[model samples]
Target: MTGERDNNGVVGVGADLDSLFAEVEALRELASDSDKARDSARVYDFGIRWGALLSGRLQRLAHYHHRGELTPHEQARYEKLRTELRDVQPLAERLGIARPTIPLEDRR
Candidate 1:
């Protein structure tokens, strides 16, 4: 039962991340359109929403990491999340969106 539950959780996380990636790609396309003014309200709205979503995801990953002593697999998963968050931070900054601050403990 525990194994099933863990697999379900992993699947859910993968689905959520996939959805978020699609949203981010859509936002990127919108931002890159020649007709769209960068300073337009629509752009800012999307940027803000994307930033919030990314921030929430990072926080959840951090919470998961700190939940208990992680097995090797869990540690690897957490590292991947951290790397992804780092990769996205600069894009958020470029969009004039506030980037999430990853906790110092998670830096390791």
Candidate 2:
């Protein structure tokens, strides 16, 4: 759960998602600190890129789900991604960054 690889040297998707969520939270915190006046270009860039990657992955997952090819595990992953995107989108908007659009079919 700490995101370190296990004895098998394999990382779980949950760990990866946790790490990504931590990163987004860090960026959001930094961006929202009113007294710091930090340069936020890097944070914005990272958010945009991460959002794009999440959106693309969700799109593919939705396609598979629609085709009845997604496994239960994949459906769980899709829900996780969708939830993360929902959280991130609001932060992006608050930061004045362009949030990646989740397809209509993929929105919960």
Candidate 1 lDDT over residue span 9-106, tens digit each: 43344544555556556655765675563666866887777777667764555555566434556556667655665665555566676665765335
Q: What CA RMSD would you report for each candidate? A: 4.7, 7.1
Query: Model 2, 24-98: lDDT tens per residue?
Result: 666577567764324577656766766664565444455555655545665565567567657766666766665
The model with the greatest TM-score is 1
* Model 1 RMSD in angstroms: 4.7
Error of 2 at 105 (Å): 8.5
Can you tell me which runs of candidate 1 are displaced by over 4 Å? 1-7, 27-39, 68-78, 103-106
Instruction: Give lDDT per model, in order.
Output: 0.58, 0.55
Per-residue lDDT, model 1, residue 8, is 33
State the displacement of the C-alpha of residue 93, model 2, in Å, after optimal TM-score superposition.
0.7
**lDDT for predicted candidate 2 compared with the true structure:** 0.55
Ten-residue stretch with the least lDDT total in model 2: 1-10
TM-score of 2: 0.53
